[model samples]
Target: MLYISSNLRSLRSKRNLSQLAVSDAMKFGLDQYKKYEYGKNTPPAESLLVISRFYHISIDLLLTVDLEKVSIGDLVTLENNRIVLPITVDCNGNNLVEVVTQKAKAGYAAGGYTDFSFISELDHISLPWLDKNEKHRVFPLDGDSMPPHNDKSSIIGKYIDKLGDVVDGKTYIIITKNNEMVYKRLNRNGKNTFSLTSDNSFYNSYEINFSDIAEIWEYAGSLEREQFKPETNDINNLTMVIKKIERDMVEIKAKMA
Candidate 1:
C-alpha cells in the first residue's frame, strides 16, 4: 500500500514549513499530525483534503508519487490542483520518449503533458535513434503544409532547452499559448517573434510572437507512413514535361543519325 508519510514530509521540507504550523493550519492536534508524518497513522479524508488544498496538490499525488524527486517547474495546474509531468525514467534515470498521437493531440494541448493522469492514459513507445539522455516527444503530422513530411507522418522532436537555442531554417514543432501546434521551418524575426515557413508553397508563411509560444521542440527525424511523394507546383510540372519532350527529340535524332 502507498503511504503519504514520506510525501508529506517531502512537501513540508520543500516549503520549509514547521510540523506545528501545519497542524495549527489544519486545526488538528500536534501529536496527531506528527503521527501522520511518522506513518503511524493516516490523516482522515477531511484532513487530507485540507492538506491537499493547502499544498495546492492533489490527494492522489500526495498519497502516491514521491514529491521529493519531482521538480516544481514540472508541475501544472489541473482542476485546481498541481500535478507533475508524466515522465518515465529508466533504472539508469534516462527519460523515455512519449508519443502524441492524433487522438491525444487535443488533450496534450490542454496541459495534458504535465498532468500525470492524462499522460499515463496515453500510449508510450521507445525509438532506437533517440538517445535516452535527451528529452524527446513524437507528434503526428496532419497536412501537406510541410511537404515530404506529408499527412499521417510522425516527427520525433528533441526538446529545446531554451528559445535562444532555436536555429534559423530548421524545422520545429511550436506549441502556442492559444493551444495551436504548428510544424514549420523557423526563422527568427526579432527578439519577440519568429517567421514560420512551410515547405509547400501553397500555404503562406506567418509570424508568431515568442510571448505566445508555450514550448518549442526541434525536429530531429521523421517517420513516414509510406513512400514520400514531393509536392509539385505548376513550374515543376512544366519543367518535367519540357525535359520529357527534350528526351524524346534526342531519341528521334539518334535514330535518324
Candidate 2:
C-alpha cells in the first residue's frame, strides 16, 4: 500500500501533475487526496476511476503494481506482488496477427538461385493481417542481422506488413546482397533499396535490392523471453531464415500473377 502511494507520487511527478491539481479535477478535498496518497486510506472505486481518467491509465495501473501498461490481450504475470505485462498486439484495427512460427520456408537454395517447388507451396497463403479485404501474411525475422538474442529460426511464421507500399515505421524481413535473409526494421530511404537495421547494436546496417525480395508480409508480435541473455540463439536465427525465404516465395508468386 505504501508502495502504491510512492508510485502514485512518482508517476505524478514524472508527468508533472500535482496532487492538488488532481484532487481539484476529481472534486476531492486536498486532505482526502493526502490520505489516499499517504496510505492512510484506500482509494474508493470512484476515486480510482477518476485517477485512471485523469492519468489516461487503466484502473489496473492506478491501484496495482504493474507499472508497464499493456493492452487487454497482452500476457501479464502477477509475481512478487507486482504486475509484469508483456507488450502485445493492438486490437484496435491494427490488422496484424501472429501465426505458426515454424517451417516458414522449405527445400534448398544453391548459390543465390532458389528452387520454386518449396516456394510454390507458399502461394495464396492467407495471413492474420489480411482482415478480409487486405491480402497479406505474417513474415518472420531471420539470420544474424537480428541475432545475438533472437534466433532466426524461432520466428518462422510471425507477421509482417503486406501493404502494397512498405510504409515507414513498419518492420520487415529483407534479403541482402549476400543472399542472406534478415529480420530488419524497415525504414524506407528514397525509392531504391530499403534500409534494413537491427535493434541490437552489435549488428551493422546494410541495404537490400528490394526487387529480389520474395514477399512482404505484416508484423504482429514477438515471443518475449523473461530474461535478456547477451548471447544470441542459433536455432532462433535459422527459424527467421526460413521465414524470409517464405516471404521471397510469396513475392515471386505475386509478380507472376
Candidate 3:
C-alpha cells in the first residue's frame, strides 16, 4: 500500500513545520506539495530521492511505513529501516506477538512491512517466557523444505532489524522483496549476500542478495499444530531379526536329528 502521501503530511506536522515552509524548502510548488500530501498524485523517483534525503528516512520506509503510527526518530535509528513492526503490548506491558495465520502468510511479505492495519488485524498471543523487551511475531510454516516445521506447525520469530546482524547457520524467517517468505539457515557469502539452505536436502541451496531482503526474523521457538508421529520401521526391523534367528536355530536342530 502507498503511504508516502500520509507520511509526508505526518512528518511535516510532527516537526511543527508548515506546508508552505516545507514546499519552499523542497523546491516544490505549493499546489504540487498539496497534491502529494493529499494523495492526489505520487512523487516520481527523482522527487522521492529528494524527499528521502530531506526527511532523512529511507524511500522504502517513507513509501511503506505509516509514520502516523510510528515515531520517525525511532524508524530512522533502526538499521536498514527494513520495517516498522506494529508490535502490540499487553496490559502489564509485556509484548504480545502477532500470529500470522496460514492464509495471511501469502500477504504478510507485502503487508507486514507496508500496512499497519493489516498487521493489527492478525491474531496475537503472549509468550511470557521470552524477553519481554524484544519484538516478536508468529509465522506459519509453509513448505516441507524446513523439516519438522511443515504446514502443520508454526514458528515464533524474533525480529532482526538489520541483515548484517544475522548469525551464520542460524534459522530465520526471511521475507524477500519479491513477496515470498521462507524459513532457512543463512550463511553469509562475504559478498553482501546469504546462502539460504533448507533443512530438507532435497531442496537446493540458493543465494539471495541483501537488496532482495525485506525483513529478517531469527527463530525463537516453535509451536506444533500436529502431534508427534511415531515411526514403526525400527520395531518391524527388530521383529524380523528375531524371527530369522529362530529359523536358523530350528534348521541346526533338524540337521542334527
By TM-score, the best candidate is 1
Clashes of 1: 0
Q: What TM-score, to 2 decimals, does candidate 2 have?
A: 0.35
Per-candidate local distance difference test: 0.76, 0.49, 0.79
| Poorly placed runs, candidate 3 (over 4 Å) | 1-83, 230-257
Give TM per candidate: 0.62, 0.35, 0.61
> RMSD for each model, in Å, please?
10.8, 17.9, 11.7
lDDT of 3 by residue, 1-257 (tens): 77899999888988899999999999999999899999999999888877876787766567765767765454423335443345555554455799999888888877465566677688988787888657789888877778767888898999886665789999999888888888999999977789999976656689988878777889999999788566437886587578767877887999999
TM-score of 1: 0.62
The sequence of per-residue lDDT tens digits that candidate 2 reaches over residues 113-213 is 13223332342333443353332333344444554335433333332223235677666654333444556677776665677778654455666655545
| TM-score, model 3 to reference | 0.61
lDDT of 3 at 197: 98
Q: Between candidates 1 and 2, which one is better according to lDDT? A: 1
Task: Please give the distance, in angstroms, between residue 82's alpha carbon in candidate 1 and its true position after superposition.
Answer: 10
lDDT of 1 by residue, 142-252 (tens): 787887777679998987746778899999997776778889999999777899999866566899887777677899998777986666789987875787678778879
